[model samples]
Target chain A: MTAPLLRIENLSVEFGPRANPIRVVDDVSFEIEAGGSVGVVGESGSGKSMTSLSILRLVPEPPGRISGGRILFDGADLLALPRNQMPDIRGRDVAMIFQEPMSSLNPVMTIGDQIGEAILLHQDLNSAQRRKRVLELLRLVGIPDPAGRIDAYPHQFSGGMRQRVMIAMAVACNPRLLIADEPTTALDVTIQAQVLALLKDVRQRLGTAILLISHDLGIIADSCERVVVMYAGRVVEEGDVRSIFRNPAHPYTRALLKSIPRLDDERDRLYQIPGSVPLAGSVTQGCAFRARCPLRVETCAVDRPPLFAFGPSHKAACWVTAEAAQARSAAEASP
Target chain B: MARYIFWRLADSIPTVLLVLTLVFIAMRILPGDPAIAALGDNALPDQIAVFREKMGLNVPLWRQYLNFLHGVVTLDLGRSLISNTPVVNLLAHHLPYTIELTIAATLIGVTAGIPMGVLAATHRNRPADSAVRLYSLVGYAIPDFYLGALLLIVFSLNLGWFPINGGGDDFPSRMYHIVLPALTLAFLKSAFMGKLARTSLLEVFGKDYVRTARAKGAREGRVIYRHALRNAMLPLTTGLGMSLLATLSGSVAVELVFNRPGIGTLLISGISERDYAVIQGGVIVFALFVVVVNLMIDLLYIVVDPRIRVQ
Candidate 1:
């Protein structure tokens, strides 16, 4: 089989000094095939955003650093690449779209110039060519009157239009991988749907792989083929979206599924998790989700459960799933 | 933008008029009379009366005020009570000196202070940042005259690197003489600019657009100078406007210390000699100069930052 387009192995991001660091993204690993879409869903501060930032090496230094990780893109160790060569890889191979569209764009710069900037960095195009490409990209992103809006500043555009401009800039270079960090959380529902549809359309047309990071499961379910559920900085479950939603193995994943307000359900109160995720670095031993896990066993407190295979291409970090897998394997061997 | 400028100039009319009225009232209420000051106490009563009438000091206060207002409208500042030279000519001669000093000081402050501030903010918490912070603090703490005296003692008295007093006649000599005073004035203003730039740059660095620039694979230098600095300049421009006005008016102390013949010196000599016309003319001119500069800065704000243009 062909290798995955991007692979992250045992990646860990920490805050504070090396002597006493606070682990925020702890030993997480995932992969995205070429032109495949993967969604990372977790609550705020779950290190989902930091994981994506690590891929681009954009995490703020001093307070935050990648303590341990190997990010491989197209068989090249991105983490080991020289600092100066990193910029060449960033907008050329991978690009990112941020959450706050209004703030993500430079207010002083024209939309055309901002989009042209990315093109200029990676492409060897002259000014006229760059402007043409900028207009073309703006049009591709479904901006109205691309020619007229080209010279307008970010403030002149609405929140949705600004996001479209951001998307145009991100995809301008035709990068192989696009990492979006909660790209639509700041927009209204109608705008969010448009942005999601745009992302899907972009992926289909350009054949670019997407690593979508968001807290909204519905968004992930609608857009991504594979989903990785993160809990307290660890991947609690990984599987196809349909399988994960149908039979979630990890207790945290189950709780997350339940917490969503269903349209057909007549329940008076929406289901909520009992407690918040523990602060980073405070959970020293055992499972990070044990405090919030409803079915946590005593053994969960003594030993951390590695991801156990629950089914073909499905893994969950839970003792219950581990035991169930073990029992099924033993029964099959006896037969 | 043109309309905005017109409105600003219109709004400043009352301000200029108020300044003129206050200077007129203060000149009359002050103890010394220009006629007695110029003629001396030894003059006879009849001679004093003739001098006062000739200078129009013998007229009623209201009529004299109207005459002064009318003369100002016609661009006639009258003559100095003591020197009898045209006040306009005196102003024309001395105003250039003050303008030159202000421009030099502003140039020094902006060029040195902005770079220092950028250095400090980018390398925050390092030795360079600490050093710049301490330097700006010292700059703020020391008064302009005290710093001028220190510069004079070090560069003038000890090393003989610059002249201690007197603005020379020729351009080169004037420039040579102006350096020490300008440096003294620039030091304090630069400190202020440095602080303003550092804070403004720091705040812009934290903005989301800066992060977006970085994420776009922009080199660090381009991200800072191209993207961050422009946004940072809005606040810095406002600070600069205040600094320009302050330096224009604050030159008084520095001028006295350096013994330079600028507007500050002219105003001082006018006050001491009871030259009311010179004093009034100098104050009005100074007010007008400041108003015009501030108006220019306001116009510049729209150019530097497009967000303000819409407002």
Candidate 2:
């Protein structure tokens, strides 16, 4: 197979002193094939957002730094790219839509100008051409009366419409990859569905890969084809969306899936995970999720488990399940 | 917009009236009698009575107040008791000097101060930022009058770079004479503007939209100037209005030290001579300036920030 469009290998983002740093994103490894969708699902402080930010090198430094990473996008190592050249790649090749649509946009700038800015940065378009493109982008993102609303400030638009405008700007250059960091978290439930649908539609129309970061499993399940479940800065499980949802191997993943309330089950209280995620870099030598995992073993405390295969594309980072899967596979081969 | 201006103008009437009343009261409360000030302390009682009668001071206090109000409304400020010149002409002659000093000082302050602030903010916590901070600190610590004396001694006395006294003749010399006093006032004014702009720009730099602009692959200069600076201007506009008024007031002390004949010097002389007409006129003019400036700032708010409406 051809190389994936975006390959992130053992990316680590840290904060505080370098002598004893707090690693927010530790050894995060993932990839997105061209035009494919992947979701990084985790609770708050699980490093999913940092992981996405590291792709565009947008992490605020001094407090937070991408300490180590090989982010290879389109056969180039992004981590090694010069600071000045990075701008050329960002918004041109990899665009991002942030969580807060209300503040993400420049309050003083007109919507048309903001969207046109993205196109103007990369493309050699004149004022008229850029304006035309901006109008077209507005229409594509489902903003009504694109021409009339073009001159309106950010305060004029509602939350959902603002997100739509954000999406329109992100996709203006037809970027190869779109990193959406909880793009719909701030929207209403009904509006959330509309935004997610619009994202999917944009992905299809522009043929852009998406790295969706969200805490909500429902959002991930609805929008992404592949899922990477992260717990305390480490990926606990990653696989095809169907396999991971149906046969979750990591204890954290299983608990997360069970926590979702189902109308058919008729439960009195919605299931909740037993323990909160550990602070980053707190569990140095052991598994990050061991405190919260139901299937924790002695081995889990002493050594961190690597991603062990359960099938061709499904893997889980767990001492108990991964070892069991390994022994069962070996036994089947021997027989 | 017109309606907003009209209402603002209406609002200023009460303020002007209060200032006029305060000037009237303050003149009356002062120790020297108007007749004694105009004539002499040893004048005959009949002569004093004739002077009071002519000036309308012998009438009841209510009637005198009504006459004063009528004079204000009719723009009949009467002649200066000392100079015998019409108070309006005296003001018209000297008002230009104060206005020139204020405008020149403001121009210098904004032009110098904004760039200094931009530098300090962009290089926050760096050596350059520290240097700017230190400059502003020194600028604030020194009073403009003291600084004006130092400049006068250094540039005018020692070096003979400028003339020692007088408001200067012709447009060129006026520009020349304005430099020292304007600079003295501007020294403090720029310090204020620099501090204000630095704080405002620093706050805008931390906002989410600035980060968004950077994420859009905008050049650092573009992100700062196009996105951040415009937003920063809202607070800076308010600060500028206040600083302009401050500069106007500060010019008074600087004018005394420099011996330039401006409105402040005129008012001071009027106060010493107990020239009630000149004092009242000067106070009213200053009060009106305050009102007009505030109105202009309100108008500027609409231009700087689109969210604000005239209503």
Candidate 3:
């Protein structure tokens, strides 16, 4: 069997004072195989970004620190590697496309200079060679009039074009895994689709594994083959896209799935998960998702549920999934 | 751009007229008579009257102002009351020295202070940054005269490196005399300039693009200079504009303290002897210098930023 490209095991990140470092990502574990796509769906305050930032060791220091975890890229412990070695690993091994494209790009620099800087830093290319490669990278990213557009500033480009430039920069080094964090959030719906298609096309051409983080269920549903549902700071559910879509096991996942507005005969009142993602102190013991979980039993509040795999692939962290989970699942599916 | 330059030149005309009017009125308003200095101290009222009539001081203030404006327009400043030399000739001789001094001081401040600021800001929270901060603190606290004296003692009097005091006999000799004085003035302004550089750079480093640069595997040096430092320098341009203003004004103090023969000496002597022509002409020229320097600074603002230039 082919080995998985990326594996994150028991990863946790904390920020604030050491004595009581606020746990932002708590024991989150997942894996993505080569050329595979995974979507991490969560709300604004969820640990989605923290998890992504940890992979590249790009978390801002002083308060934010990766407390515990093994970020294994092809079974190598990424967290153990030194910073000098990591820069090559970052853009060359795992590239990241940030959410705010305009801010992430150097405003004073031209589009060509900014893109060429990536090549100049990591590769041994002279001015003429880097210019050729930079122009090629701009062309490959589907920028029209690539020769002329290379000299434009960030402000000179429209919002969509700026994002395309950002995409071009990220893929300039040709990494295997691309982590796109809300890549389409700042764009209009039409522009959002165009950018998303550009990302999808690039992934297909390069055969790069993509960890797409988004709050938009439609984008996730359309883009990812597998999905990891996070609540508070922990993974609440994980499954193949078809299984998760057809039958969501955890009540939080169920509520989330139901909440997605379907085009056909949708209810006038859209379904919403009651209450917000729970506060840290409010759900200190047991499962972090228990307060919002509709299937909260006596055992759920006191003792957390381990992720029990019903099939070879599907897994859900819920107290109801015990020896009788398969029977319970079939009974529920029978209408 | 053509329209803007035309407007600026047109705008300057009224300013020159206003300054001419003010200087004419002020000379008349003062208590002392310029004719007194022209005549002997023990002269009678009749001698004074005769002296005043000959010197054109007996004319009414409005008529005197008109004559002053006419002379200014004609490019003829009448002879100095005490020296009996044309004010134009004296200014033409002394203005170069003051200009050279101010320019040297400005160059020194810009060259030395920007690097110090960049270094201090980049090395923030470290000992080097702390030391720069401390040095600048000491620099800002002390007056320019005391510092100039201290420098003179260390470099000229003790080490015999620079000339002690006096104007140069020639251009090269004048430059030798100017080194200590220019450096003195530069050193005074650089404390503020350095602090401005480092603080602005530090602030720029905190911006999002700096992070973006670093994330792209940019070396720390290039990241700070290309991405952070360039942006940081925008605000420093504003400080530099104000510094030019301060530099011209500070020449009076620097020239006075060092005894280098420039406008400062002319100004002080002009005031003491109450030589209205010398004082008025000198003040008017210095005022024009300050205003023109400010205009050049405004023009420089456009050069550094294209967006500003286009607007």
The best candidate by lDDT is 1
Show the colliding residue pairs in model 1. Answer: none
Over the stretch B197-248, how does candidate 3's per-residue lDDT look in tens digits? Answer: 9989978877777776776777678887888877776788888878877777
Kindly report the root-mean-square deviation of model 2 from the true structure over all alpha carbons.
2.0
TM-score: model 1 vs. ground truth: 0.95
Say which prediction, candidate 2 or candidate 3, comes out ahead on lDDT: 2
For model 1, how does the per-residue alpha-carbon lDDT over A150-176 read when each residue is reduced to its tens digit? 998999999999999999999999999
What value does DockQ give for candidate 2? 0.72
Best by TM-score: 2
Write one digit per residue (lDDT tens) for candidate 1, span B90-170.
988888889989999999988999999999989989998998899899998999989989999999999999998987789
User: Per-candidate DockQ versus the true complex?
Assistant: 0.76, 0.72, 0.46
Off by over 4 Å in 2: A330-335, B1-6, B28-33, B36-40, B60-63
Q: Summing lDDT over every window of 10 consecutive residues in candidate 2 chain A, give the lowest-scoring window.
A: A272-281
Q: Which pairs of residues collide in model 3?
A: none
Error of 2 at B232 (Å): 0.8
| B272: Cα error in model 1, Å | 1.6
Candidate 2, pairs of clashing residues? none
**Which ranges in model 1 have alpha carbons more than 4 Å from their true place?**
A325-335, B28-65
Report the C-alpha displacement of residue A73, candidate 1, in angstroms. Answer: 1.4
- Mind giving the per-residue lDDT tens digits that candidate 2 earns over A8-75? 99999999999989999899898999999999999999999899888889898767899997999998
Task: List the RMSD of every prediction in angstroms.
Answer: 2.2, 2.0, 3.7
